[model samples]
Target: MRKNPERRASLLDAAIEVLAREGMRGLTFRAVDTEAGVPGGTASNYFANRDALLTQIGHRFYERLEPNAALIAQAQEGPRDRAKVVALMHELVERVSSFRSGYLALIELRLEATRRPELRRLLTERIRADVDANIDFHLASGLPGDRTTVVQLVLSLNWLILERLTLPDVFPEEQVHDLVTDLVERALP
Candidate 1:
């Protein structure tokens, strides 16, 4: 395997696109190399095997999904009220809409994990860490929810919204907003 960070990142991004556009079956090293506009063997050089490539794609999805610093700062600086929470939820929805492809790839990763024990373990750990971090953030921000409530709310709402967003015509835009608002109101104090 080669050690080119930039190339590796580009190939992973290409992998995401391939996964999104064609699902798991289409995510081959040659496909990634073609998508990345690199040499035929470039992706194989960076990724030892399909499992390694898929794992990296899962990692890249989260890495690309780190919350925007400016948005986080804005949320932190402002009052931590229901309004702020609703706005944050809307922001999250907008983010999901914008990165529909990445989210689709993430969904594919989750399904693929179900049949692979190692990937399943890795994804489970990653998800738990994410939930823990979200819980901590909510507590630190003085959000009105217990850890369990927050965890359930975040996981449920996020997946619902993501599924709807990636698969168009599932829910109307206004309905999505209204549903999210209703959920937030109930989730928060």
Candidate 2:
């Protein structure tokens, strides 16, 4: 009911922390309030319900996770060969690795969405747009993959690599790099 942007952002950040640490089952407004060190009911004041909080969390996740302008510019300047694509993949994996908790929270939100049709539809549209953007980026950068192949590679390999890197010692960095390289090479023209 109140219009406090900073407070809202803090609540969302706390929600992400709660989601990452306690999973969706633990993502109550009270949990977020505790995580944010705010008084009880603080999160609920900002978000009307769990669905609203989860939706905002999903939106904020993408806002925080999308590649920045500088990164995009750097990618644009680089050679658009297989090596560059592999390098980009490495960058992506490294970014996810660095933000492991945030990404894990995202994964939890995704899983939670499956049970809610409205949430599922919203997230599906957002993910599709993200994939479309990736496909366009690849084409603009002169990478050698058709839209279908790029879509598949992005959705499948990104999930696999993210899941692998999130868990303990599932795969080494070199192995991930090699795997991404192989995938990119296969997808390339």
Best by TM-score: 1
Using lDDT, give the best candidate's number: 1
lDDT of 1 by residue, 1-189 (tens): 899898899999999999999999999989999999998999999999999998988888888877988987887876778888788788877776677778888889999998998888888888788889878988898866679867767776877677586665677666888877877888775
lDDT on C-alpha atoms for all candidate structures: 0.84, 0.81
lDDT of 2 at 69: 92
lDDT (C-alpha) at residue 10 in model 2: 89
Model 1, runs deviating above 4 Å: none
RMSD of each: 1.4, 1.8
Runs in model 2 deviating more than 4 A are none
